[model samples]
Target: MAKGLKKTVVLVGMMGAGKTAVGKAIAQILNVPFLDSDAEIELAADRTIAEIFERDGEPFFRTKESQVIERLLNDERCILSTGGGAYMRADNREMILEKGVAVWLKVDLNILWQRVRHRNTRPLLQTANPYETLRDLAQTREPMYAKAEIVVEAEPGLSVEQMAQKVVDALVAHGGIVKDT
Candidate 1:
């Protein structure tokens, strides 16, 4: 495991960008805690994200997501994986920027589509034409994602561990965020 992380690493991107999986691997390698804002929300609400969306609404879900993200950012230095839409809100983005290192995982639409197509868990993609919805969401969000301090491309066919290592390498090479204890 690696050590001596100066700040929390917040993983942000689309739903299928592997934020949770890669964040878990990165946290394990860094010997830091892994926090998923979605999981936290689910635990707190006693319901799945989809259920929450169905019950209250997207506005309610976004509010809860922001709250959970703020709470998580205030916690110990760790790897935090946020819901795909978390960073879209300015308040949430500000909180993440203030409290953690935001790394946007950039993946192509086809790759993202492939990863998310089979899964019916995405609230936003629960549309009549999910593929087009995803594409449109990606287009709208790419500019905001580009505002992140670091950008790590998601290569097709890479294992989760490799993707995590790639993020580590990006941190070391670009910002020196992680170092030997």
Candidate 2:
């Protein structure tokens, strides 16, 4: 239940890690709202993330991202899904850790590639040889992601609902963040 958590469950991970989907499932199971920072940004800007990246650049998007993340984390406790790059910033990471329990949804590189390769919506993967780009991004960002208070490993065949349950189970197991009662 939502009452089990003292703070929001901030889901952080790579693009294909199913943060949004799993966050939705978690929120449903917990009886709380699911807030997505990227979606909030899109709603505020009246444009898609790819469009924002194309027009204003990533630095600008990231500035808005930090703003949205802070706002979302500041709101009522919920399952908050953040963009893949949100945890890459120290300030955002600090804010997340301060306001919510950060859960890193760690997925395998091959599984990540499989999940994201066909999606044109991801701006970061729009480079030449996206597989290599995703690998590079993962290698660059994983150490920071590893700093999350909770790390939930993702399996290749698990459904979104199952992953959400795994995340909630991990939270309960973590003790201080989520109470079993």
Candidate 3:
């Protein structure tokens, strides 16, 4: 299945868009490696993303995020799930475009909120009003995410496997990243 891959498929979107889950499913379907940039960063730093942000600040964390993304894009042709903010940086966007195909998992704000509200793993949502924060972040990031090579709508009714299939179908129809296997 890996024989037809030409570039990495980088999943980008707001938190709770199921990037990691869908990415895993797609990688499994395609028989390719699956990587999550946030998980990679946490492993490299020997700490969680929240701890990295709290200890070194966002700027520092973003620096590391950029480096990790750059490395991942260059490392292999696989499915990569990036952090919510990863595509916001111009440098990261450039690298992703150059070396990989960015697939935005387009999910609405309300659905995103429902999926993420109970999760304490998101450091950015630890705020006085997390819903408002998420809304603002979504508004700010949507335009940039729209610049991705492929956009896959994430319906609330779709299971993770279903969403992954939707993305795979899009990639196949678009004929940009994932090659026919």
Candidate 4:
């Protein structure tokens, strides 16, 4: 339907939680821009996130991440997909709350594992015991993720379009968007 957004939708969650995928679909539905904080950071750093972590480390990458998030939040309202760890910081969470409505895509551990297990792109999951690592991350981050303004539970077997529509419906219900979902 291409309904426009009244507020920026900041997609936040774990690495395999479908933030980027659902965000792209949401932007298309809303006729708005889809901005990924991680992608922006990569463009600014001229390197991959993995490379950034390898060379400069997580703290440095997080600093650049905060800067990029601030810049994007100040731009036109868009569907902003953030890195998995972005919402873990208090400053980042505060800024997101002020400028946009945060949507946490809550997915089950098994589903998240299935989605990300084969992918080497996630720097954090590159561990000796990747499955255990993913489980631990989900456990640790769930509390922070629960602080998001809107929580959209991602059910298994739903297509990206379906998941996006669910988010849109949630936004309308929460008054985050003035649109027909």
Candidate 5:
């Protein structure tokens, strides 16, 4: 962790855990650019995530996702917010860890359900039993998410700003901002 190396702050967590919102706040505080992988994918594909999944399928969307993430990792400084499923893939997780410090925006399942239930765009939650699907996804991803360099709890009652500050504080505490290699 040298002082000259580009520092990247990457946020990973379940859907609706406020990664995009918090990543923006962190970027503003750190005076760096914020990049959301999902948004980048949408921009590159010229379609929404739901449309990509529906028209091309999950595999296609994931390929695009990995590509976007790889490009972003080349940056020297950025606050990156990844899709919920991104870290579940081995290569994605390894690339993030190698290129930057990853922060897990942890949120409880109940809170996640409340935030995501009405969003039909979430392919995994589009099942007839969304609750069960969410529960399963959360369970499966929690361990992987926990492997992040830092973990910040996204409490239901806390404002996005508060969570953002918490992430920054955690980054500072964990020696996340390092010099270039």
Candidate 6:
């Protein structure tokens, strides 16, 4: 990591894992722009994520997601929070790894359920049993998420600010953020 080179910090994890919130905080701390993949998709498609899923389908949504992510990766300095399923795909994960540092916001299943249970927006978890769905998804994606350069656990009792600070620290520790000489 050259000090003069621009760095992009990409946050990857399950839905409701606080990637958007924490990524925004990290970007503010680093004084850089923050881009949420879902928001970008919504802006480009002129429809909410749920609407995209409903009207088109997961495959269609994923295609748009890949396009948005590809565009975002071109930014030299940015904090990007990707959709939950984005990193699960091999090509997407490889692209992030090649372009920047990927950080996995690891959250426990119980905590994830608590945060997202009431939300009706998650297309993947729209099942009759969202908890089980979350558990299965988490299990399946854990290995993929582990491929990230940095991993920060989003524990209970930590404010978003605290989580953001932890992410910054992890980035420094993992050599993701190099100080300009």
In order of listing, the candidates' clash counts read: 0, 0, 0, 0, 6, 0
Candidate 3 structure quality by residue, lDDT tens digits, 82-112: 9999999999999999898899999999999
Best lDDT among the predictions, by candidate number: 3
Give the clashing pairs for model 1.
Answer: none
Q: Which lDDT tens digits does candidate 5 get at residues 42-80?
A: 998888999999999999888889999999999656899
Q: Supply candidate 6's per-residue lDDT for 10.
A: 87
- Candidate 4 residues 72-100, lDDT tens each? 99999899999999999999999999989
TM-scores for all candidates: the values are: 0.96, 0.96, 0.97, 0.96, 0.93, 0.94
Please report how far candidate 5 places residue 107 from its true position, in Å: 0.4
**127-152: candidate 2 lDDT, tens digit per residue:** 98999999999999999999999999
lDDT of each: 0.91, 0.92, 0.93, 0.92, 0.86, 0.87
Worst 10 residues of 3 by lDDT: 1-10
Please provide, for model 6 over 1-105, each residue's C-alpha lDDT reduced to its tens digit, 9 standing for 90 to 100. Answer: 223325788899999999999988888777778899999999998999999999999999998898889889986668899999999888898888888889999
Better of 3 and 6 by TM-score: 3
Q: Which candidate, 3 or 6, would have the higher lDDT against the true structure? A: 3
For model 3, the superposed segments whose C-alpha errors exceed 4 Å read 1-3
Stretches off by above 4 angstroms in model 1 are none
Clashing residue pairs in candidate 2 (N, C-alpha, C atoms within 3 angstroms): none
**RMSD to truth, every model:** 1.1, 1.4, 1.2, 1.5, 3.1, 2.5
User: Higher-lDDT candidate among 2 and 5?
Assistant: 2
